[model samples]
Target: MTAAGLPMEIRSEGLPTRVRIHEVGARDGLQNERTVVPTEVKAEFIHRLAAAGLPTVEATSFVHPKWVPQLADAEQLFPLLGDLDPQRLPVLVPNERGLDRALALGARRIAVFGSATESFAKANLNRTVDEALAMFAPVITRAKDAGVEVRGYLSMCFGDPWEGPVPVAQTVRVCRALLDLGCDELSLGDTIGVATPGHVQTLLAALNEAGVPTSRIGVHFHDTYGQALANTFAALQHGITTIDASAGGLGGCPYAKSATGNLATEDLVWMLHGLGIETGVDLDRLTATSVWMAEALGRPSPSRTLRALSHKE
Candidate 1:
């Protein structure tokens, strides 16, 4: 049975009975690595994630090789991933050119990212926040015309690297812009992993008040200070039903030096299952996938829960 088939009576108070997990280990998780992961290895990692029952996985980014050489194999990787179940894979497209490349390679889904903080926008995309939003408009329109599903990302929603704390107002404004641009869904990112439960509550409240439905907002938290799970719970209380996580805590923010890895998929699934939240993911299978990915990366799995469970076994 899928996770949605599970009994829902055990869910936490105020928590959504079901949640969607957008796995990003193959793309966001690997983008910052110094060593280039071979295209075959990347494809194999994605296959393992699919076997773990992830409904959506960000397969790779279609950015310029000059900016992120780790994903320079995108053109090669996409074709290699042709064997994957097309219903689950989405590629990141940084601009119209990137989207065009993805389309040429037969990509059906794409993600465009902007930032709530001006400095982060400038540093990451070489444009101001508004400029980045403006840049995405044409891309979003063209993609819609092509019948491609588009997901928007608002990075540094909680805090910025150059600037200190980000205002809730700023995040809401960026979110409104992305929605107005016709993005199907928006992932609000805690780029630096500096958010607390209070910050999550405040931001969600502001977004809610601004007329953004919780169903359209997805939370992407980093576990830099071990606050990811807490923030995620807080988001759930505010009616968020979708989350973005990396396998084995595999990713970190490139713009924030102090930021650690993303929320571990094993840990998140463990918590969600305990809460009886349906995620359509098998915890045991996901834990095994995390272990395999860690071995492939030549690093210990960053999930404490997975490590402890493995030790017990």
Candidate 2:
């Protein structure tokens, strides 16, 4: 361990050789913003992310405009991403209605949202835990039949804002349902960011015991408790390679006011690259894009890497 007491990234072993970062800045990152970003600007931001070589960018959500006003123009925004590879741009779909809208617009890849805790499911989706999974069942099946790949999101895997700590078995059960519904992959989200390294390791180990392969799971973390990176490191050491991050640390959960933004892509890239793990991201170009995006948002980026690098210019 370093003098700072942080776990050092081991170059020789116990680390992934490559990591696939699922970029969520354009969708989850911007969804709750109070300011209305122009549809074209949102499109351009995604374009920049793709150009920076993000493997998968959550482009937009097909949820009702009344719920998330910021991304109300999903229809308009999706058309702008026509030039990007279809698989690289996945849109969030709450149910069949959202799924139909996305499919009508040529979206081949989509994400179905669920929750591990009943409190968050009720507050966010207005449905109980079982009800939410019931809702996602048909959505996931229909999407798969349409030749559209489905990625599942299970929020509040670690803890919930309304309900305190979530049980690992509850998380595993929810994840199993999503996968059984035929979701190609599942992103376990620490919606409130209350997860620590020990929590991360325990969760993954429990999921493994539940018969979920590490290859099919990705972790989405928030830096709210300042444990995102440490938790990610723990996950990596435990043989999980996929991670979800936002550019410039751009998103925060609307339900939790005290929570900070999602783990920053630049910050994750800095650590992964330093540890000799390949992510195929251009750090300099990505940093420039973050600076550009911060200017567009009319604020400095929250990424310490982006902040320090921005000052060097």
Candidate 3:
């Protein structure tokens, strides 16, 4: 290993030449924090992420403050990022009202959160899976009409806390429903992080068989069981180019008790770069940003790559 902790480059065959990282630290990373970060600090965090070469950064969520009090400054924080490309900054909208709030702020891209299981749907949305899909239909339609791109986040795709292991067909059904409802792309979330690499490949193959192209899908894997990277490699082998990651491995489902922090962007980038895959991300800069954010939160980052690199410094 190098002094900076970077792995030696080795290009692997059958993997995409480049991958698009969907940075969720600004939103997902901070949303679960009990410590309320100031609006200015949140804005700086996004700015740092963008400067670090993260092309797509999820800015904030338009969900009500009562639901996610940490991101309650969405309104105040979004406007401050006016200088960034609007298409690169995606916000989360829970319903028509959330979409309205986001549209008012000139958000050009947005994402809707959903679940593949009944238990998570009821716990997170207080609605059945079908009812939740119904709620997102109008919001997605309106977003399409407004010419805004919409992404669908399907949580508990592999397993659920209350529902144990989810069936592949059950997950595929919701994925198809989200695509049919007009989502531009879908993110399959291993929320409780129980997915194995074989399970990942099986799900991708099943989705492809069900007519969902791998091009229109992304993988969001948490490191709860330490399978995030292994699962991500399985997805890359299946031609999935979009990945959802949190810098410094910060994030978890507030609704899912067993869920943990997402796959660390530093770890993902390190793996990508070492594999000779182009992600257009500067590893050093990204690691520094994570360290900075960790200090802001008054704690050390959980990302193994971040800890290793920062420790060497």
Off by over 4 Å in 3: 2-5
Q: After aligning candidate 2 to the native by TM-score, how far in Å is the CA of 300 from where it should be?
A: 1.0
Q: What overall lDDT goes with each candidate model?
A: 0.88, 0.89, 0.95
TM-score of each: 0.95, 0.96, 0.99
lDDT of 3 by residue, 80-106 (tens): 999999999999999999999999999
lDDT of 1 by residue, 1-313 (tens): 2343322335667788988999999999999888889899999889888888899989999999998899999999888878876557889898989999999999988999899989888888999999999899999999999999889998899888788899889899999989999999999999889999999999988888998888889999999888999999999999999999998888886666777899988888878987888888887778788888788788898898779667866
Best by lDDT: 3
Which clashing pairs does model 3 show?
Answer: none
The full ranking of all candidates by lDDT, starting with the best, is 3, 2, 1
Best model per TM-score = 3
Give the C-alpha lDDT of model 2: 0.89
lDDT of 2 by residue, 1-313 (tens): 2442223655748788999999999999998789999998898899999889899999999999999999899999899889988899999999999999999999999998888988778888999989998998889889999999999998899988777899888899999888888999999899879999999999999988988999999999999878999999999999998999999999987766656799999999889977979899988888888888889989988898888777766
> Which regions of candidate 1 deviate over 4 angstroms?
1-10
The best-first sequence of candidates by TM-score reads 3, 2, 1
